[model samples]
Target: MSLFLGLDIGTSAVKAIIIDAEDREQASAVAPLSIDHPHPLWSEQHPDAWWAASAAVLDRLAADHPKLMSGVAALGLSGQMLGVALIDAAGRPIRPAPLWNDSRAGAECAELDVKVADFAGIAGARPMPGFSAPKILWLSRHEPEALKRTRCILLTKDYVRLCLTGEAISDRADSSATLLMDTQAGTWSPQLAEACGISTGLLPELVESGEVGGTLRPELARRFGLRSNLPIAGGAGDNMAGAIGAGVVRTGDAYISLGTSGVYFVANDRFVPARGQGMHTHRHAVPGLFGQHGCVLSAASALNWVAGILGVVSIERFLAEIEAADLPPADIPVFSPYLGGERTPHDDPLATATLSNLRGAAGPLHIGRGVIEGVAFAIADCHDALIAAGASIGTIALVGGGARSRFWGQLIATVIDRPLLLPPLALLGPALGAARLARQASGGGLSHEGDRHGMTMLEPRAGWRPGLEERRAIYRQHYAKLPV
Candidate 1:
């Protein structure tokens, strides 16, 4: 039984899973995480919280399935990307790490846009407040003292890796999106670093996503019910891991991750920087391949927020009833879905959410249905942006927590007017993908791209298109007057 553990340090939680040789999930656990918004546009989580959550998750997994965990051969990691977690020479986090959705670095992003020549061409991602470099730039000016104390910089998963291995390392696939790497060269770019008021020395050593990052520490190994020599694979960022998990390795293959944030990912054989469009052209976890992504700052998170506002306790039941009601287009209000601003296409950091066309009789169902359709429309916007950027679109795979809703998936497919592929383990694709990487790192493979044969497909219904199209126009109208 060659078992592997896959852990994802996501924005909302730390999820850990153990899988066997047949790609069967043997054990799993999750620990919830909360973000801090100290200021209007700030979003942060102490690096300690991630490590704490990770430890708790691992401890639970080990306790629940000690025998299964003891048989684990290796571990793989995956998580959110492109935010700075600064640690000092004393091996202490300087402050709470600014997260990927933090929009406080808007001014710094503009500075880099002007300072770094050919910003998009060099970094393969648009200069945005959500990226890592700008977050560092924001720190450099706002809190120079913190930068002075910083010895090493890490991304979300790498920070947790530092805790697990006592080594500072990162994967190329995750680092490529940091705006500090030369996308074409696949190496740290000193010029880009300098423009962001930092140097390559602050960054961690880069490794291939499937290579051994470091061995687990003796103490943590005992806690995990594993041997000290258990290797941790150089895991990928969520998008890359999600791609590999969904068997999106071949060129023109794509997946739509309806996770905390919405990501439209397309695999490519070569660098395809979609200049002018907000698509990210970066390295893939699969060696020697590139990927393009259209990221929506808020996807499922936006819907979750609206649900909370409506005082709905059971999200599944709320969505079920909304799906049952099948409200007409006129009853569903227009939703902007920009709770934390946006990234793809608009790149507006100040954009706010809006629910328009609300009637006096509008209740939770109307509001809930509106938000659902709104997210689908927002996804369509991502599809259009990627298509305009010349990314080849074929059948799309939908993978994430939001994909659990049949109505939501169908609605999104209808809005995009495309079919969707649903993998059996769609909800935790990144973790599963990380396990796949772990298998590769151990030189013990169990599956191939051809394994996608078991995936189920969701075809769009033409009946829902016309009404959704009319509402999407209203949604666009609201977005056009954004940055409010």
Candidate 2:
């Protein structure tokens, strides 16, 4: 049986999985990663750390599934999008990469809008601090020497691909989030590059998500105990890969992801950006398709925070306690899930998380329920924005770590007032999507019917409608009063 490997370079970890042609997972491994926050609102990681994590995971996979590793035909990579990985001419990182959650480029965002004419029209999104272009601009102003020495600027996963194949390339799905791509044209925008005081030559070459980026280098292959000629598929950003993994390829297919961040992602057959409203538009991993998403900086992370605050040893335990308490929805306090700032509908990086109207009687259970409700409301905010932008969201596939919670899934459905479809193994969506891309890059045809196996559905409870609506209104009131 032919096998494909998928590597995900995520914000907090690196995960790899091996899957056979029939999409059966043979083996998988993950390595934890750390982010450096040297300053407020700054998230950075060394590119070499990503390489180390990738190597460690690959080593584990090779050890556990030697047969699968040996027969692996192609590999695909996915990662957090909008990060800036600056590499010098010799393919070495000049500095730690500014990650997607980094918000140190506020001034540069204003400058970019001024320097680049019609920036929104070209980039298909507002200039935000989390994007690659603003980080590049920040470097140009503060770290001019490093910017000058920069020979290539690649996204997170592309840098990993560089280490594996000795080539620098990126996919459209990742590049489109950079605020430097002419998203509609599927190319780098010279005007945006000039605004950042850089040249387009510094950007990696762009390709479709499933295209062959490069083959594994002989030396690197030997080090990892793999084939020398293994092809590396141009994988996608985490959102796009998650969509693919959920079988959301055609128009009107959408999903809500509740991971470190929360996202409302919808596939589009044509380019339609909601830049004015702070939503994101990027190319899909599948060719000739586009994706629009609204992102909230905190999702399940908020629940984890509540768990930690409650002194609970496990999130599952904390959630169970909250559910057992049977806290009424109307009594739940309001929480604004802006712990790491926010994206989508409000491009405010300085925004902080808020919990309001907590009664003296409220305790850990109340707070926990509020956190879940807050996250659901935040996602619903994005959903409303998407609908306003003319997205016809019918049924949403809920995917991510948070989807493991039946309580949270039901809450999201109630708050969003939409039917939620939970695919089997939803947490593995991004990895599975990467494997699918690898299969295509290795000359295999796409047939994701297997992806839909054992799907489950969650419909909104009509009885919960009024209470959720009241909670949403209160959230809106408190959100409006938040200090900008």
Candidate 3:
């Protein structure tokens, strides 16, 4: 049986998997990685580090499952998006990549918003500092030497693709996040590229998410003890790949991801710009499709923060305490959840997380439950906006680190007032999505059509609905009283 490789280049780590053409996992490996934050608003990782991690992961997989190596037929890659990985003429990294989480280009973003009024019309979304165009401008102005020496600009996955295939290429789904592509047309935007003072000559040729770019290079193949003929398929941004992995491929299909940050994504068949300024509309991995996603600065990260503050308690113990706590006080509390400001509803870094209506009786359990409920409510706000804008969201699929907790999933379902579908596999996340892409590229594999084999449904508890409603009402009353 032929096998496929799925490599996910994530912010914190790199995970690689070997799955048969049937989508059955044969071997898996993960390598721990870290990023460098040289400044308050900067996040970067050495481009070489990704290559190192990929090599480590592939070597370990081959070592663990020797039988699967020879059968590997194709490789697909998925990665954290919107990175600015500039490279020299020789294809060497010029500097550490500015990651998606780095927001230092805020001023540059404001400038683009002013200079490019048709930005939303062409791209389906507004430009943010977390995107690449602004980062490119930042490099040109702040690091002129590096910019002058640069001959290629790549995203996280694109860099990996280059190392494997010796070809610098990017997919539309990944390019869209860089704020440099014409999302509706699925092409590079000369207008935006010109405004950013970037030379289009250095950008990689764009392709679709599943298109074969090139065969793996000989040296890379030998290092991993694999064949150089294995096809390398175009991979997408982590969120798009995660969406595919979570089975949110159909129109109106939804999923809420809570990792370091949060995203609520709804797939749409046609490109549609959201009316609200808060939500982002971007192209989907499947060509000619788009999605409107809302961003929440903190999701499980806030919970993690609370846990650490209260002394590193296990998630099980935390939830048990929440379950034992007297039903959340009947009174509503307003929670901003802006431990680091917000992204969707309000794009303000100065916005602080404020929980109003907390009395002396409120303890850590109430706080924990409130934080989880607050995140769900925030997602609901996004869904409501999407619905108002004519996007139908029938149900939400939960995928991310946060979805692993049944208690949290239940709370989200109750608060959001929708059934939550959880894919059976969690470790697979984007890597599984990459495998699905790999299989699709190979002509035939397990289909993503079935409802039973890959999903677990979480419905709002019959008894919990009333309490959720009451809590929502209380939250609204308090939230309304706050200054806009």
- Candidate 3 wrongly placed segments (more than 4 Å): 324-327, 330-334, 355-357, 451-454, 462-484
For candidate 3, the TM-score is 0.92
The residue-by-residue lDDT of candidate 1 on 221-272, one tens digit each, is 8988987789999999999999988888878989998899999999888887
The positional error of residue 42 in candidate 1, measured at the CA in angstroms, is 0.2
- Candidate 2 vs candidate 3: the lDDT winner is 2
Give candidates' CA RMSD values in order: 1.3, 1.3, 2.6
Error of 1 at 46 (Å): 0.2
Local error of candidate 3 at 370, Å?
A: 2.6
Quote the positional error of residue 90 for candidate 1 in Å. Answer: 2.3
Model 1: ten consecutive residues of lowest lDDT? 445-454
- How many backbone clashes can be found in candidate 3? 0
Q: How many residue pairs collide in each prediction?
A: 0, 0, 0
lDDT of each: 0.88, 0.87, 0.78
Tens digits of per-residue lDDT for model 2 on 224-296? 7788899999999999998988888888899999988998999989788666666878888888888988998
TM-scores for every candidate against the unseen true structure: 0.98, 0.97, 0.92
| Per-residue alpha-carbon lDDT of candidate 3 for residues 55-132, written as tens digits (9 for 90 to 100) | 899889777876687678888899988888998888899889998767788788778888887787876777775778
Model 1 spans > 4 angstroms off? 446-450
